[model samples]
Target chain A: DVKVTQSSRYLVKRTGEKVFLECVQDMDHENMFWYRQDPGLGLRLIYFSYDVKMKEKGDIPEGYSVSREKKERFSLILESASTNQTSMYLCASSLSWGDLEQYFGPGTRLTVT
Target chain B: EDKVVQSPLSLVVHEGDTVTLNCSYEVTNFRSLLWYKQEKKAPTFLFMLTSSGIEKKSGRLSSILDKKELFSILNITATQTGDSAIYLCAVESAGAQKLVFGQGTRLTINP
Candidate 1:
């Protein structure tokens, strides 16, 4: 079975603080993605990595950055957290970049106060 | 910009009923469309449609895509309470490694 795990299920941070959300996949997938889910907005892509050290910006990448230093791990960084940045963060992995089939990890609900 | 739209943002029905969820897309270099069911946690994969007129079935849930029309429909027959969740549709364009998701349709089933 494919397993995608996130570093935290819930988090709280104060404004101006730095936050990091981590995701790891055991399927050795070559594609990983970061998304944020908000009510009435669905899930919007924040960033994605196709290979180690290779990153691409999705539709909404402002105020966020990603790191993929290893094949199994992908990290999303909030340089400075803001109240409006609070959202449910999701991570997904796919076997190939061209494949639309993806497995998502349990989301992290972050509260930025 | 690539766009994915889902009709009837919310629906309420009773158990044993049948329902159809619709997804339409406007994208360049369209590759595939995917459906997912999300509960309180992460969204789980349901089906992937890349070809027109070919139906994908899993138990009571089935889906068919119309590439020529740029739309897809998911049908669930004899729905149960467990089938209640937010249904999401996403599209992938060529060379785009990420999926563009719609707002999702929230479904409720009462016994």
Candidate 2:
């Protein structure tokens, strides 16, 4: 079984604060991703890392940045959190680009006031 | 931009009923399609379809892909309350590491 772990299951932050969401995978997967899920909007990709120090912007990457200093860990950074940024964050990992299956973490629900 | 669409955004059914969830995509360089069942927590992998007309089954849940039509369908028979969850469909593009997901179909099963 593959396991993807998020640092926090729930978080609260004030507007304009900085926030960090950490993710780690035990499967030694080469690809990791961050997504935000909203009602009626489904899950939208925020950022993804294919390898250490290599990152790419997904469909909605504004106000967010990611770090992949190591193969097992990926971090999502909210440089300036806002009320609108409150949502459910999910992290996923896959064995490779050609591997279609992605294992997701339990998710973190963030509230910004 | 790649697009994945699922029909019947929500459905309500009784136990022992059979249902079909639809997913269609218009993705460039299509490689595969995947189905996931998500409860209140993270989405769990259900099936992955890379070829057309081949069916993948797990207990009461089965799925088949139609690459030529750019669509896939997941069928669940003898549905139970445990089968109630948000069904998500995602497309994997060739040479890309990310999965583009559909809005998902929310299923509700009542005894």
TM-scores vs. true structure, each candidate: 0.98, 0.98
Whole-model Cα lDDT of every candidate shown, in order: 0.95, 0.95
Task: Write candidate 1's Cα lDDT for B1-111 as tens digits.
Answer: 899999879999999999999999999999889999999898999999889999999999999999988999999999999999999999999877779999999999999
Instruction: State the displacement of the C-alpha of residue A30, model 1, in Å, after optimal TM-score superposition.
Output: 0.9
lDDT digits (tens) for residues B1-111 of candidate 2:
999999889999999999999999999999889999999899999998999999999999999999888899999999999999999999989987788999999999999
Question: What is the DockQ (computed on Cα atoms) for candidate 2?
Answer: 0.81
* Residue B70 in candidate 1, Cα distance off native in Å: 1.4
Poorest 10 consecutive residues of model 2 chain B by lDDT? B91-100
Q: Please give the TM-score for the first chain of candidate 2.
A: 0.98
